[model samples]
Target: MIAEENFSSCETPFLSISSRAILPHIHMLMKQAIPCFINYIHSENYKKKNLNEDDLTQIYIEQAQILIRKHNYPFNVNGQYRDITNLSKGFSDFYFFPNELGVSTNSIYSVESKRLPAPDKFREKEYVIGNNKNGGIERYKNQIHGKGLNECGLIGFVEKHNFKYWLDLINSWIEDLALSNRNWNEEERLLEIESHVDFCFLHSKAKREEKDIELHHFWIELGNGNSISNSKK
Candidate 1:
């Protein structure tokens, strides 16, 4: 059972604590869900010879829902919430619904997923950085602001062999940001915001005639105040 003190009730939307406070719990939830996902993928019942991006995405979403139910999380699992004025969907993939029925963006958790096309090549910094724009990070950035969500969880799917290298690349990116921004103290601020973002990579070793299969997950802090754009400048 999750300790009461570890998580703040959805009622307190403007709670002053750093957003990072909830990350560990989210990580724990995802960690617990990963094994279930692997089992399902490898199960005899599963028979997708060539899993497309959408196929894998649906599996992840389903697994997340299962975990949420198993733990009796306070938040509702799935629904489409929209901003009538903007005519934009608040949570594209899924969101943690607050107790109140209304769409109070700040009170919920958001999740997004992306699949890596070439997992083996993803280890190279150039490949990861170049592909990021095409990989849907930009779309996620837009969703973050348009929805007014406090944070978003990003999931990446890749091949098993590429898992370690891909993770190393991400670490290098963070480290590089820190080194480059050392003079401006932006590193500390960026890392603090990064603390609120949780990343989880899930890889699969199933032999595919064409390509490798895997998945990764990340929880990103969103909204105007958390933008990393300014820090880059």
Candidate 2:
């Protein structure tokens, strides 16, 4: 059993999807919440400050907890959650712990967040593939994360440029890697689902070891507006 703690019972509107049978339902729900969180942070109307990856992750958790409690959702969002199944693999940025009735499970949906254009110039490729091979995509490709799960996610905090700009750049980088890296292929490029002025969502599939790992990519802009319009695609 995955740990069940800190959650209190509450009345909520029923959502149709079953927790154990449908992982995609959880994925969709989580994706839907991104714009909400983006708006949640912006709604505060505080003086704009440059927030790092961790800051954004924390904000996401806070917003998710609100929904979990309000809706009685079985899953929980955890930051820096370790994979107890693999003690040495290290913690993921966001672990959507799959649970039943608020009880945790071994099946974890891990997501690693990255900053587009990286905070430093020297680490420019860190969004697609990192210098130390810890790039958002590289981690799963190298078995650094999601070794057991067939799917994982990545979030790009677009500190610079638009979503299309980074998407093309990242796909180009992946195509370049496919030339020499046997594990990489052109098929791993992110394909767009939808986008707006403030957020973009895409999906990609990558080869990990002998199996295929699906990747869901979300990038949120933190530029001039920092808020999404016509929300929730």
Candidate 3:
């Protein structure tokens, strides 16, 4: 079985206590990764209380650690990226619900993430593999990137290298789809999966022109609604 321990059980880690120090620099990072992020808000527990940007950032960071523990991927939680105009060196903009499976302990929650196309760039942005920023897995230094799953047993994707910005696209799709009158449940979950993959391909291609662009990739595993690993990444 695909268990969290299979990835994160380790002596050294991709992220350490020192990684927490990167929190102060996240504000600028969020801007570049998700231009619309400032307008969006998330609930602290979804049912408990409303959250501001600070609360959301903290949650993103905390859950990232849990996700790392579950996925056991090698990423410097405090790693930096340069020459990206919209993002900070080590910041992740908005992490979606499905992208946050590691944090949800309740069995009731479904896993999912969403992405939306930019309004002005929609035409130029091909949500296709060949034309979009995602040049495919073979082009990246890390193979498993921008892959996320949802609560309704659906899996979505983004490019691993450009995950921070791509997350914005995913959130936009989720928000729009959730608010639409269309019955998402009626369609096969595979439809959504295919849509996600397409979006990743297109978004990756669109951003390829950016000078010195980079993304911090995150992978989340939700097993029966709980994280399976004891060791935190």
lDDT of 3 by residue, 1-233 (tens): 86655656544323332222432233223222231222222223242344332343444445545544565433313211121332222222233221132432111111112111211243212221213333221112111222221111111222133433544554454345436724211121111111121122211211211221122222221112211121111
Per-residue CA lDDT of model 2 for 36-142, tens digit only, reads 77776666462254456677777777777677777766676777867777653656887776545534455467888887767777787887787777788888887
Taking all chains together, the TM-score of candidate 2 against the true structure is: 0.81
Off by over 4 Å in 1: 1-24, 79-91, 99-107, 118-134, 143-146, 170-233
Instruction: Summing lDDT over every window of 10 consecutive residues in candidate 2, give the lowest-scoring window.
Output: 224-233
Least accurate 10 contiguous residues by lDDT in model 3? 185-194
When sorted by TM-score, best at the front, the candidate numbers are: 2, 1, 3
- Number of the predicted model whose TM-score against the real structure is largest: 2
Higher-scoring candidate on TM-score, 2 or 3:
2
Model 1 misses residue 55 by how many Å?
1.5
Q: Tens digit of lDDT per residue, candidate 1, span 96-116? A: 543334334443455554444
Model 3 superposed RMSD (Cα)? 18.1
lDDT of 1 at 142: 38
**TM-scores of all candidate predictions against the true structure:** 0.52, 0.81, 0.24
Off by over 4 Å in 2: 1-20, 43-46, 101-104, 225-233
